[model samples]
Target: MRLSQAFQPTLKEIPAEAQIASHRLMLRAGLVRQTASGIYTWLPAGLRVLRRIATIVREEQDAVGGQEVLMPTLQSADLWKRSGRYDAYGPEMLRIQDRQKRELLYGPTNEEMVTDLFGSTVKSYRELPKTLYHIQWKFRDEIRPRFGVMRGREFYMKDGYSFDASYEEAGYSYFRMMLSYLRIFHRLGVKAVPMAADTGPIGGDLSHEFLVLAPTGESEVFYHHDWDLMDWGTSPLDPQKSEDLDALKEIVSKTYSATDEKHDEASWQNVPEDKRRSGRGIEVGHIFYFGTKYTEAMGVSVSGADGTAFHPHMGSYGIGVSRLVGAIIEASHDDHGIIWPDNVAPYRAAILNLRPGDESCDALCERFYQCDPEGLLYDDRSERAGVKFNDADLMGHPWQIIIGPRGAKNGMVELKRRATGERLELSVDEALAKVGLN
Candidate 1:
């Protein structure tokens, strides 16, 4: 993508309402624009990052036997009413009336709707243990939505539902999802600790919220240092194995991690003083095992082995797809701007033409850009070197390929790593190779 033709309208001055690093940087970097209170229009660059995050989330969900399905953003209020939560959900839910005067709502969450959908279809124990998921936009009427996409009223999310015939089976599904969420965050290049959390309106005895540590986070968190050393990617645990799931669950139970709302002083005292870690963290994902809460309330049941109708245990898992964009920025950015991880960056690298109109410089940049045009952002704009350099840093591509006239004339270029301000002078081919463009 050429900067000259790109629709990224980066701001030099910070927006007055942006209170956090992610919010201020998102606006300054031209990732999104506020269209209404708590609502945003994701610009091209922002959309790319959103899509990449969703893709990683989808892949992880699929690995856990979750079948992809698209649910409606607007749902009939009858489902909520049947689940006995219509009146209980409160003002955060945007209740509405259609032209026919029928009640409807922009779904804040899909527990009731998904329960109804599952009940209307699968009807036996043989089809038990099915998980369905979708990546879609969700709306919640936040009284005061702020902090950019981090707490936006309307945001993209990946929510999944699991249905099982027994409590034990549901437990397996819950553990499997915990594993999946760990891998998801790991691949997205963030360390999100899974902490025991209250179910709240979702209504579940068992729940865990994945929180990414950041100085600007809203909630204070306490955790064990072991969380930092563990790597989910190399774990031998398989989702289909019951023993493996139990082992995973055991590790989680033994770990002392919680938000301020659920912190236990007695349990905190059990941890070794040196191993205890505390910081502020932003929530990016949540998982819950509500058992028969929705199924019993909505009269959803599947046939048992004895041919008797019984409510299937259920669980819901959620990842804030859009909020992750901001949460990631909060956790990863430096003074310059967003330091997008390799897997989720909008572009892998930015190819800067330090002298755009200069024939040698333009040719070298063009060569680098052509190697992977789709994955590289080319700064071909007729702007000063300072302007290009600043924008490249502000956008925060993983790498920067600098093509200045002096080096371009000698068929050489500079490769700079965005995370660390390390630059290397190399041959044109070597520069491309370093950025994985070759």
Candidate 2:
């Protein structure tokens, strides 16, 4: 798209409220704007990046056999009441009274609601073992919400719930979810480590939170030094057999990893000091195995092979969709703006037309822009060459193909890699081939 008419409001001065680099860059880059305390309005450029992250989350979930479902943000308060959490959820749960004075809430998470859905529809062991997910908005009234979208009160989230007729079956699904989370973050260009964690608000005996390491992270965590060396590749994790899921679970569970809240001093000391690594971590995803907590509370029962009614084991997994955008920025940005992974960048490249109206420069930029599958943010705005160069770097596209009258006259365009500041001048034809259109 042409920057001449685009709504990219680049800022010279950083907003004081933005304490981190990603938050500051997000504002200057025209990705998002604060709508309320912790709520935000994602501008076109920001939303494009957000959606790309969501796409990767969806694809990985699908690969792990999760069927997508869109759950309502507003859930019946009665469901939470059944789980005995409506009154205990504290002020974070945005409680409301509907027109009839009935209690309702903007769901913080959907385990109870999902359980209600499961028990109402699923009735037997034959339909056992199903994983369903939804991508929607969730609200939690953080008393002191800060850090831009990183700890926002209102955010987009991708949450999934799994159901199985037996506890053993549910455990396997949990493992698959862990493996899926590992792959998702790796593809997004970061190393995300899974650590044993307290269930927190999402209760269960078994839980894990996937964290991407960043010095700016909130949670203090400890893990093995070679934690990043574990391989969780696509080795055909078919969940048809119980052992398939169990084996994966064992491998992941055996690793020494835990968040501060879940840390055990005695257990950790067992590992040699050289092997222990402590660092701050940002939670990107979390999963839980809460056996029959919601199922029994909501009377969600399925008939066993013996025809006896039994509550199914259930679990919920979540990726803080909006928080991840910030987490990724926290993990990946440099002196400029966001250096987005090719998969989630709003535009793959920025076309800098230094000699805007010059025939040769104009012709080359227009051609390059046309070749862009929404891949180019063509900077045809009236600006100095230096201004355009700075803006292109600030916007952070991987490739910046600069066309000037001089370069055009010489039948060449200077191509620069945003990440490395490496420049290559290529012929018009060569530039086209190098741009590698969307």
Candidate 3:
């Protein structure tokens, strides 16, 4: 994309309200703009990253046999009332009234609604197990919505629901999701630790929260230093048939980790002193098995093989899609700007026309463009060399290819790695090859 024609409103100074690194960098780079308190309009660049993450999440879910569906954002209060959570839900549940004076709610989560949907569709034990998921916008009215999109009142989220006939079978689905989520985060170049967590309002005894250690995280977490040593993603997931629950528990049991709520001094003492690393972590994903909680409450029952009415065992998984943008930055950014992973970076490389109007520089940049380069943000703006350099660094693309008259004379262009500030002078063809534009 050409910078001259792009709608990036880059700011020289940080916004007064942006008090953290993620918020500051997001504003300075023109990735997003505040539409209101805690609500944002994702500018082109920001939308690109958001979509990339959403795609990865969807791919992982599909790989594990999850079917996708869309649910209404506005739901009737009747469902919540049936689940006995209409009054239990706090102010965050954005309550509203239609012109008919019917109580409606912007769903904070889709448990009750999904239960109502699933109950109407399936009625036999043959379709005992099914997994449904959706990527949609969710609204939770935060009293103090700050820290940019990190704690936004309105945000996009990917939520998945699982239904089964038995508690043991649904627990397997939880394990499958845990394994799938590990790969999802690894593909995005972020390491997440699956720590046992308390199921807040989601109502489940068994839950795990995927935590990404970030300096600016809200909750302090304690864990063993070898959290990354386990290969959870490579583990087998055979949810259709029976699996060893004890073996899976053993893997998670090896790690001593918990959010502050579950941190126990006795358990922490059991680990070697050197392996203890207590720090703050951002909650990226949560998976839980809440069997018969909403299904029975909403009367979502199906006939079993024994010809008896049975409530389908159920589970729910969630990832804060919009909040992850800030969490990623928190885990992987430097002083210049956000160091985006290649998988999520808007553009893999930035081709800077150092001498924009110069004949040789413009000609070479035009050739690069003519070649239909992949993932290149061509900066062909008529600006000073220093200004271009600073902006390129601020954007923090992985590779920077600078074309100038001085280098064009020598048939060479400067290639620099954004993360390490390492540079190599290469011929036009070599520069193209280095960035895979060739």
Candidate 4:
């Protein structure tokens, strides 16, 4: 992508309403634009990051036997009414009427709708352990939607529901999702601690919230320091093995982690003082086992082995797909701008023509850009060197390939790592090899 032709509207100053680092940087870096009080239009660069995060989420869900399905944004109020939550859900749910004056709602969550869909199709225990998920937009009508996408009223999310015939089977599905969330966060370059959380409106006795530690986070979280040292990848968790899943659950349960609402002072005192860690955290994912909450209310029962009617135990899992783009920035950025992780970055590297329009400089940058055109963003704009450098840092590609007149004359370029300002002057080929573009 050439900067000259790209639609990134970089700003020199921060927007007045952006309060946190992620919010401010998102505006200054031209990732998104506010279209309403709590709504935003994701620009091209922002959409790229959003799509990458959603892809990772989908892959992890699929690995754990989650089938992808598309669900509607607008839901029939009849489902909510049948679940006994039509009046209980409050103002967050946008209630409306269609042409025929029938009641409808913009779904804040999909629990009731999914239950209605699953109930209308399956009639026996054979389809018991099915999990369906969708990546789509959701709205919650926040009274005060600030902090950019972190707390936006409208945002993209990945929500999944699991149906099982018994409580024990539901717990296995819960544990499988817990492991999947850990793997997803690890791959996204953040250590997200799974903490016991109140189920809120989801109405579940068992719930876990995945929180990323950041100074600008909204909630206070307490955890054991051992979470920082443990390697999730090395854990013996096999999705196919029930014993392995149970073992994983045991490992997580023994760890002392909880949000402020669920924190137990007595339990905190049990841990060694040195191992106690407390900090502000941003919530990125949540999973819950609601058992028969929806199934019982909506009469979504199937025939049991004994020929008796039984409600399917169910669970719901959610990941803030759009919010993660901002959360990742909050966790990974420095003073310069967003330091996107390689796996989720819009472009792996930026090709900066330090002396744009100069024949040698242009040729050198062109060579590197062509080597991996799809993976590189070429800065071929008619901007000053200072502007180009500042913009490159502000955009925060994982690497920057610098092509200056002097170096380009000698067929050389400088490769700089974004996270750490490490620079190595080498030939164009060497630079490409360093960035894995060769």
Candidate 5:
């Protein structure tokens, strides 16, 4: 993506409405623009990052045996009514009526709808366990939506539903999702701690919320220091094994982590002072083992071995696909701008042609840019070197290939790491190797 032709309208002055770092930076970096009170239009650069995050989410969900499915944003009101939540869901649900005067709603969540779908389809115990997921936009009428996408009314989300024949089977599915969430966050280059959480309207005894630590987080959190040292991605626990799932559950059970709403005073006292860690955190993912809450309410059941109808235990897992964009920025950004993790960055590196028209500089940058045109953002704009440098840092590419005339002429270029502010002078070939350009 070349800067000259890119539709990234970066702002020099901060928008007055943006109160958080992610919100402010998102607007200034030209990632998104507010179209309504709580709605946003994602720009080219932002969409690339969003798609990348969705890809990671989709891959992780697939790893856990989740089948991809697309559920509509709008749902019939009858589903919620049958589940006894149409009235209980409150004003957050945007209830509406079509020209035929039939009731409908922009679904805040898909528990009732998904339950109905499951009930209408698979009816035998042979198909007892199934997980279906989709990445889609959701709308909840937040009375006071703020903090950019963090608390937006309409945002992209990855929601999955799991159905099992029994409570024991459901427990396995729950723990499997817990392990998957941890791995997903780890791959995205963020440490999100799973803490005990209230099920609220979801109505489940077992629930966990994944919160990413950040100074500007909405909730205060407390956790054991072990969370920081543990590497979930490298863990040997396999979701396919029941014993491994149980072990993963045991690990979570022993860990002391909670939001302020659920913090136990006695439990806090039990932990050694040195092992206690407290900070603000942003909620990014949540998992709920609701058992038969939805199945029972919506009359979803599968035939047992003896041909008896029984409600399937169910669980719902959610990751704020759009909110993660902001949560990651909140957790990883420096004073300058967003520091996108390499896996989720829109472009892996930025090729800043310090002297675009210069014969040597243009030739060197073009060579590097051509090596991986799709993964590199070529700054071919006729702008000053200072502008190029600032924008490169603001965009937060993992690497910046700086090609000044002097260095280009010598067959050398300066390579800068965005996260660490480290610079190295390397030969053109070495620079390509360093950034994995080829």
Candidate 6:
């Protein structure tokens, strides 16, 4: 992607209504633009980042045994009625009427619809423990939607539902989803702690919210230092292993972690003062084990081994895919701009041709871009050095390969690390080797 040809419309001044760093930076970096009060149109750069995050979500979900499926954004009112939440879901549900005056809704979540789809297909316990997921757009119609995509009326999300034959089997499924969430955050370059959470409208006694620590977060949470040190490594998880999943759940659930709504002062006091940690956090993902809550209400039953019929226990898992773009910025940005993690960065490295027309500078940048054309963004615009530096920092590519006239003439370039203000002047080959672009 060349800056000269790219459609990113960066702003010189921050929008007055932009209340947070992520929101302001997103606009200034030309990642997104507001289309309405709570809706946004993701521009090229923003869409690239969003799609990369979705890919990571899909990979992790697949690893945990979830089958991908596409579901409609507009769901029939009959589906919601079957779950008894059509009226109870409140104004946020975005209820509407079609030409025939039949009620419909822009799905806030997909539990009811997924239940209906699964129930009508799977008919026996032999097909139990099925987890299906979809990445799609959802609407909530927030009365006061603010904070950019963080609390937007429309956003993209990855929502999944699991069905099991018994409560014990459901528990294992819950653990697998929790582990998957942790791994997703780990890969996305954030530390999201799982805390016991109220299911609220989700109607579940067992629920956990994954939150990323940030000063601008909406809620203050308390947790032990153990969460900071414990590592969810790159090892793969098998959802079918009940014993292993149960053990994994036990380890995480025992940790002292709670959000403000469920905070326990007594529990907080019990932790060693040095081990106690408190901070504001953004909720990025949530999982619920609402066994038979929807299946029973919707009359979704499967035949047992003995030929009797019973509702399968169920759980729902969700990750805010679009909101995560802002959440990542909130968690990782500094005063300059976003510091995108390598895994989800729109471009791994940017080739900044400071002296664009200089014979040596153009040659170096052109060669670098050719090496890994897809992973590099070439700044081939006729902009001043200061403007180029600022834009590169604002866009937050992990590495910036600066090819100025002076260095280029000497067959040298400067590699600048975005996260750290570290610069290394090396030959083109050395620079490529350092960034693994060779």
How many clashing pairs per prediction, in order? 0, 0, 0, 0, 0, 0
Candidate 6 local lDDT, 1-438, one digit each (tens): 877888999888889999999999999999999999999999998999999999999998998899999999999999999899998999999888999999999999999999999988999999987999999999999999999999999999999999999998888889989988988999999999998888999998999899999998998899999999977765445555777786777776677998898899998898899999999999999999999999999999999999999999999999999999999999988888889999899899988988878898899899899998777899999999899999899999999999998998899999999999899999888999998888
TM-score of each: 0.99, 0.95, 0.96, 0.98, 0.99, 0.98
Alpha carbon RMSD to native, model 2:
1.9
| Model 3: per-residue Cα lDDT over 200-289, one tens digit each | 988989998988998888888999988867655565644333454445666678889899988889999999999999888998899989
Worst 10 residues of 2 by lDDT: 231-240
Could you tell me how far off, in angstroms, the CA of residue 10 lies in candidate 1 after the best superposition?
0.6
RMSD of each: 0.8, 1.9, 1.9, 1.1, 0.8, 1.2
Off by over 4 Å in 3: 230-248, 371-374
lDDT of 4 by residue, 80-130 (tens): 999999999899889999999999999899999899899999999987799
Candidate that beats the other on TM-score, 2 or 6, i.e. the better one: 6
Per-model CA lDDT versus the true structure: 0.93, 0.86, 0.87, 0.91, 0.92, 0.92
Candidate 5 backbone overlaps, count? 0
Clashing pairs in 5: none
Residue 331 shift from truth in candidate 3, angstroms:
1.1
Could you give candidate 2's per-residue lDDT for residues 1-438 as a string of tens digits? Answer: 899989888898899999988789989888899999999999988898889899999999998799998989998999998999999899999988989999899999998888878777888899978899999999999999888889999999999999987776787788878778877887777778889899887788998888989998889999987677765555666645667777767766666899999998988898789888889999989989999888887777889999898988988899998988888888877887778777778898899999788998998788788886476799998899999988888878878989999988888999998777899989988877887863
Scored against the true structure, residue 250 in model 1 reaches a CA lDDT of 93
lDDT of 5: 0.92
Q: What is the Cα-based TM-score of model 3?
A: 0.96
Task: At residue 398, give the lDDT of candidate 4.
Answer: 94
Question: Considering lDDT, which of the candidate structures 1 and 2 is the better prediction for this target?
Answer: 1
- Return the lDDT, model 6, position 261: 88
